[model samples]
Target: MSETDTDATATGTPDQRLHPWSWLFVLLQQLRQFIVPLLVLMFAGRGDHDAWPYAEYAEYAPLAGVLALVVVSVLQYFTYRYRIGAEGISIRSGLLQRNLREIPFTRIHNVGVHQSLLHRLFGVAEVRLESAGGNKPEGQMRVLGLQQALALEQLVRHHGSGAATTTGIAERPDGAAPAGQAEGRTLLSMPLGEVVRMGLVSNRGMLVVAAAAGLVAQASPERMMGNWLEQQVRGAAGYAEQLHLGWLGMASAALVLVAVAMAAIRLLSVALALSQYYGFRLIQTQGRLVVERGLFARLRTSVAPRRIQAWYQQETLLHRWFGRRALRIDTATGGGENDPRKLRELAPIATPAACEALFVHLLPGVQWPPAAWQGVPRRCWWRLFASSVPWTVLLVAVLWWHLGPWSLLAALWLPWSAYAAWQQAGRLGYVVDARLLAVRGGWWSRWWRMAELDKVQALQLQRSPLDRLLGTASLWLDTAGAGPLSPPLRIRFLPHAEARALHARLGRVLAARRMRW
Candidate 1:
């Protein structure tokens, strides 16, 4: 067949291999992962690379390891092959054992193209493919020619569902469709202002600093902060004592140091956010959504419509004041700290208008926090308030036994706890729309998260002893994509009658549509 005919069929006469640079990438990865062990082996057990106590073993160990790694990498490069056919893609790989992985086009949900510093320099990209039921991406092409990667990505996206198998993207004039066409619909763009907004609204910088600080402390507490920080604290106290400045002077010094640290962390966080989301863009075309962004290491992930499990809208107290929110789509493709195709950010900082447009575009016809949210009966509110009384009573009893008259102060907590519980009950509500089960929660901070009924894995009606007496029930919903540690999304304190009605309604909804996850 001609090149055009072969492309049209989504088939290649010969299997394709990764870019030759893949071996270098693999070597770097292995070295980075095992460098600590290698360093310990060299420093703790022996001298440096040039000298060792065990001249016979240590002298040849490095050479042996290097040779083995090179052999494995070469075998991997020669053995790894992927073939694209009319039905789907097949990958053949492994050095010690032979394994063939067959992935049907219909089962594929996410495709990610990553261009690192090396990939950019080499004019190649890493293309990763993931299915719905996987915790990690199943197939990855470590390196492919830039144009070829894009072509393969588009092939899976447009023709995977047999949407345009006959008139494939290869047959189209030039490369892409029109700018405003289905595949080119610009959904959201993250500007510098939005990136700044995201930075201000998130604690990622503090978290990053904390993580590094923790690692340093874990490795050597004295080297990290124990000795130096303790000495500095003692010196500050001594200086205050010498100057007759009292505790106030030491407190001021500590405050100044904390302020400086805060400013440094803030700047680092903003810079990090800007660098990560520099040119973020979300676009949709031909029933698929594609995200492209990042400054240093660019990323492009194409998400099939069927993979998305839920919509999550998060807004901190600070974020709410700016009238901007972060919107994300959770998918059942790849769930990992570095997974590009998991919680895809539709928008880092979206205005109200943008949020609505994205919501309608991503999940059309499903009303958000539906206007007809039904509140649980009034007695349910009393149950919530009463639940806090026991904890307060225990605290008050402890204070009464220990502090005598000061125990009265502990009684003050009862009213505060009851008030907080009342506020929680007031804010908590649920909306069971035809296609969605929207749960409205939070008192100090608000969150409006919803899952499609079809994606609901299990529905349970629960009743506590109090709930049984009050004729109320809690409806727990388990969505397909929920992780092991994730709490079930549910509405608490609903009337038993309504709970059963909604449970039956959920049964009907599940029956109407086929479950994908």
Candidate 2:
């Protein structure tokens, strides 16, 4: 097909028609996804002792399976054809009950291109279009070539820009340089060395925990150490029974060797993290940032500048001692079950003084509060300490009851909790300036998150019974995202009056922007 014809077919304009094979492809894709599950069920049914042998129904079963597949495939084919009109995209599908979905072009937040190993081999990729009106309205427009994907993204972006336009949101400038230009733009082209470095330095504490859990499960925790000890004692007793001092000494030496080997195996469990997170890369795309990492199965995620709800500069005690901070940006996208796309580390480690400069260059118009606004109140520490007491006491009591006299050691947690609370309170700080609001907190691991004032979706000031009694209130700031990315922009314990004043100030700022628009 000609390029123009291909574009028209891929985009499906109001007057244009879809490819004849599009619906067929969708049906096949759905069938492929279901085939394995169907086979597993068939096998499971055959294995059941109470169930009749498949041989009894074999003749009808094959025919029934074939008929079922045909009917489902036909229904899916009819449902998969989608059309693009001037206002929005329309999708129609369903078997007995037909359903139609229409999504306006204006509601689209970002368009993502996803290519799997199979897709790369086939020279096609999936295009996922996400909208701001929650997850329900979002849709996937699938399987297009690399060039076609780019054209579709541009077409959707520029659909309503001309005289027919009714939406107020302006089209992104065509010739304008991509968003991250001034901030040291890295292209689809990233150095292999940097990618390898990123993977090595990433925090693998979670991986270590996961491996430990897996090993504990496999070794039978209740008898694991005792079994090893018993084996050692039996071997020593057997050697002692031989009544040769030289042989006994040699056996003792062998026990020392076994001890060293066991210690090495335990150490290897943590070291396995190095192999899993290998070959990670942080690349700056034209209009977004891209992170590609993983060893066995690689993962790639791209986040647009506009979709970033908050940016966090984090530093643990070790990081602070090393004069380094990690930059993490939270976006609204979901990364599926095993993976998390919440906070993508931009730089694994960098100086705190350089963080703001790098942030401003990447995302323009972000403002930080003056030095005076950075101080958190001293009373916050007392509140944290008081709030932790109940939980600490309950935990200690449970340990004492369940673990007997040995559990008295759990009392040590009380002092640790107190220290953590004190440190967290000290780290908590809020910065409100002309253009943004930044919240900072965390005990051993420090975090400073800044969100643009204009992007603030909602702001709330609340007080619990205890907070009210203490004359302090908590502020909640909600932005556009799911879970952690949707964290309160600021949640520090502040004086009731001060919290109210801050809320009012933010409300006024939002009101003024709305009025201007």
Weakest lDDT window of 10 consecutive positions for candidate 2: 1-10
Top of the candidates by TM-score: 1
Q: Report the C-alpha displacement of residue 113, candidate 2, in angstroms.
A: 1.5
Least accurate stretch of 10 residues (summed lDDT) in model 1?
1-10
Compared with the true structure, all predictions reach lDDT values of: 0.73, 0.59
- List model 2 lDDT by residue over 1-517, tens digit each: 0011122223324322223333444556766877776666566545545456555454354446646776776656555545566676666555566656666776655566555555565655556666543443266654555545544554454553332332211232222222322432542222444333333344454466568777876878787867878998898777766866576686787788888865555455334433333444555544556555444434444556677777777777767665666676656654431333223566655566656666876767655434644556865776678777787678777988788877778777778877888788777878887887888778787777788877777888888898788788878887755245323466667888888898898899989987998
* lDDT for each residue of candidate 1 in 281-369, tens digit (9 for 90 to 100): 98887678888887778889888767777776766687788898777666777656355445467887888678867887677776654
Q: Can you tell me which runs of candidate 1 are displaced by over 4 Å?
A: 1-12, 44-57, 161-183, 221-228, 241-256, 337-341, 377-419, 483-487, 512-517
Residue-level error in angstroms, candidate 1, position 337: 6.4
